[model samples]
Structure formats: structure tokens, C-alpha cells
Target: MSNKTILITGCSSGIGRVTAKYFQTKGWNVVATVRSNPEAQTELNTLENVLVTGLDVTNENSVSTAISEAIERFGRIDVLLNNAGYGSYGVLEATPEQVIRKQFDVNVIGTLLVTRNVLPYMRRQKSGLIINISSMGGKISFPLGSLYHGSKFAVEGMSEALSFELETIGAGVKIIEPGMINTNFAETVGAAFNVDPTQTEYVAFVSKVMEGLETANSNHSEPILVAETIYEAATDGKRQLRYIAGADAEKIIAARKQLNDDDYMMLIKQNMGL
Candidate 1:
């Protein structure tokens, strides 16, 4: 049983919840933060070594308070997991400005704020790990995924740059790029931003695409796979800057490495039947 203390964000359902439970089972002290999900609160509270807290990642005060509370409870934070993010699925032009702002606010800026707040303690300890949960979309783009892709790309860039900056300081930064994990994330996107047939000419096209995604997501890698990947990243002595979680995720990364811009888009278009 590892005695390392870790803080994780977005622990209501899906990957975050799974990771929290997995870490607790491994004997790690975990501070799991969720944004007011009563059921999730009840479920997480059942864990022995886990501390469940209310956290709205996009809110500055909430972010600060969560970090502070974790520090107070755990004494020190050995790992910080920025896993709170959601997707906005739609064409870039079709996506509202407010929606775009909110997407970036939660997925990109929230990550920045959380990392910024937690870094001081890690820096003082001179030994800590910061893990950002990105998507395979970070490396590859899909149609109707512009807004979602943008946020993940930002995470990828930030993680890469931060990894270089932190390497010399004995701290480590890593990113987990999971591919289409079986989770409620896709359902959330479908519920939050369904394509309006009357609003755009590509409505039918988008609907078909979304249907395909819904099917794919239903049978994708389980949340436990991502949880285990995160656990390995956090505890492994030889650290890597990025760990691709699923087989599909690894394939996406490999494709990104092998294909160029036009070819990649062509492949996506073909696969998605766009």
C-alpha cells in the first residue's frame, strides 16, 4: 500500500470516480473533488482512505479552497491530477461564443488554475507529479469536435511545455491521452450540445456522426483502464511525459505520427463517413 497523497478533480463519475476508488484500494490517500453530485458524493464517501469534496473547477475560489483543504487534510500532496473536463461537440462556427468560452474555461483554464495553485506546494516539496488528462483528440481531430479538440490540444501543449520546465526541478509532469473510453462523457456531450437540424444544413450529417460516436463509446475501453494508467503514471519510477490509455488511443497516437495533415483528415472523414 502506497502512502502517497494524491488530489484528483472531477470525481463524480467516469474516469475520475474510477481512479479515486482504484487509488484508495492501492492504499493511497486520495482527495477526490466533484461538482455537487449527490450520488457521487455518497458513492465516494464509502471509500476508506478517500476524502470527497465539492469542487467547481472553473471557479477560482472553489479551486483554491479545494487545494487548501487537501493540503490541510493530507499534509502534503504528492500528485495532482487535473481530470476535470467535458466536451462540446459541434462545428466550430456552429458553437456559440459562450459555449466556446465555457469549454476552454473548464478544460484549459481550469487546468491552468489548478496546476498553478498546487505547484507551490509541489515546488516546496521539490518532488511531485502533475498529471493532466487529455484525449486522443488532442493528437487527432474529428469532425464536429472542433471545440473539444481545441481544449485538448491546449492541454497537450501545456503539458509538453510544463514537462520541460519541471524536469530540471525534480518535479514531473505527464499527460494521459485516453481514446474514447466507455464513460458518460459522450452522453453528456450528446445531451449538452445536440445538433439542431433546423439550424444547419449539415444536421443530418452531424446526427449520423453522433450516432456512430454513441455506438463506439458504448463499447470502448473501460474507465478502470484509464484509472490504472493514471496509477502507473503516478507511481512508476521511470516516468514518461505522456501515456496513451487504450489500444485505440495508442493507434490514434501512432496514426498521428505517421500521417500528415490532409491524409489524417481524409482518414477521419472516411472512418466517420463524413
Candidate 2:
């Protein structure tokens, strides 16, 4: 049994929920948070060494209160998993400004806010780990995912820089890039497509990309894989910076590294039949 505590954001479903349970079973104190929901309370409260709470990562008060509560319950936070986010896919020309802002708000800004609140605790302890859940899209882009990719790209860059700064304080940062998992995240991405019918110029391209996305979703990895990866990252005790979780993510990111910019762009276009 371990006394270490891990605070995870977005525990209502998918990766967040699975990770919370995984950590609890490993005998670590777990703070599992969701965006204020009654059902979430009942669903997660059954676990031992788990504290389920309401936390809207984009809201400062919510982030502050949840961290405080976790500290109060566990006395110390050993890890912080920034997992609260959504996919925002749309053609840039057709995407509304407000939607763009909201995309950054939830994915990028929310991540930053939570990390900022938790850093003081880790800094004082002089030892801690921060694991951010980025996506393969952060490393490689796809058409109609400008907003989603943009935010993830920001996360990758930010995590890399923060790793350097945090090392000075005896803290470390790591990023997890999952390709595609069996979750409602794909459905949410489909629903978030913002192309307007009147914008006929992008229709054919969007349709093809959507088709490619559907085909890719047909072979997604299980959420447990990601949960397991998080556990490994937390326990590996190495100063590793990134862990690509899914098979698809590993292939894609590896390819991206091997190819030059233009070749990679062509490869993506060819794969999508664009």
C-alpha cells in the first residue's frame, strides 16, 4: 500500500474515471473530480482511498476548492493529472470565433489553470509529478481539427518548457499522447464539426476527412491502456517527458519524426484520400 496521492481532473467518464480507479487499486490516494454532477458523486464514492469532487478546470474557484479539499483529505499531493478536456474539430474558415475561444478555454487554458493551482503544493514538497493528457493531434495534424490540434500543440509545447522549469524545484512534468481510445470523445468530435452547409468549398474535403476519421475510430484501443500508461509514467521514476499511449499514436508520432514537413503533409493528405 502506498500513501502517495494523485489528483486527476475530468473523472466523470473515459480516461479520467479509469485512471482514478486504477490508482486507487494500486493503493494510492486518488482525488477524482468532474464538472459538478450529482451522478458523478454516487458513481465514484464507492471506491476506497478515493475522493470524488466537483471541479470545472476552467473555473478558478472550482480548481482552488478541489485542490484544497484533496490536500485536506490526503495531506499531500504526489501527482497531478491534467486530464480534463474535449475535442473541438472544425474547418477554420467556418468555425465561429466563440467556439474557437471555448476550445482554447477548455483544453489549453483549463490545463494551465489547474497546473498553476497545484504547483505551489508540489513546490513546497520539493518533489512531485505533473502528467498532462495531450493527444496525437498535438504532434501531427489532421484536416478539420484546427481548433483541437491547436490546443493540443500548445499543451505539448507548454509541458516541455514547464519540465525544464519544474526540474529546478525538484518537480517533474510528463505528457501522455493517446491516439484514439474507445470513448465518447470521437462522438463528441463528430458533433463538434462546425462546417456550414453554405460553405460549399470545404464540403468535399470535410466529408473525406470525416470518413477517414470514422475508419480510424473502428480500431481504437481500450481506455485501460491509457490508464495503465499513466500509472507507468507515475511510477517509472525517470525524468521522461512524453509517453505515446496507443499503438496508432506510436506509429503516427514515430512517422512524424522520421518525415520532413512537406513529406508528412503529403502523407497525411494521401492517407485521407484528399
lDDT of 1 by residue, 155-245 (tens): 9999999988887767989999999888888778977784555677887788778776766676589999999999999988776788999
Model 2 lDDT, full chain set: 0.92
Q: lDDT tens digits, residues 1-274, model 2?
A: 8899999999988999999999999999999999987255776798888998899988999999999999999999999999999888878888889999989998999999999999999999999999999999899998888889999999999999999999888999999999889988988877777888998988899899988888888879999999999999999998789999999999999999999999999998898899
Score candidate 1 by TM-score against the native.
Answer: 0.94
The backbone clash count of each candidate, in order, is 0, 0
TM-score of 2: 0.98
- RMSD of every prediction: 1.7, 1.0
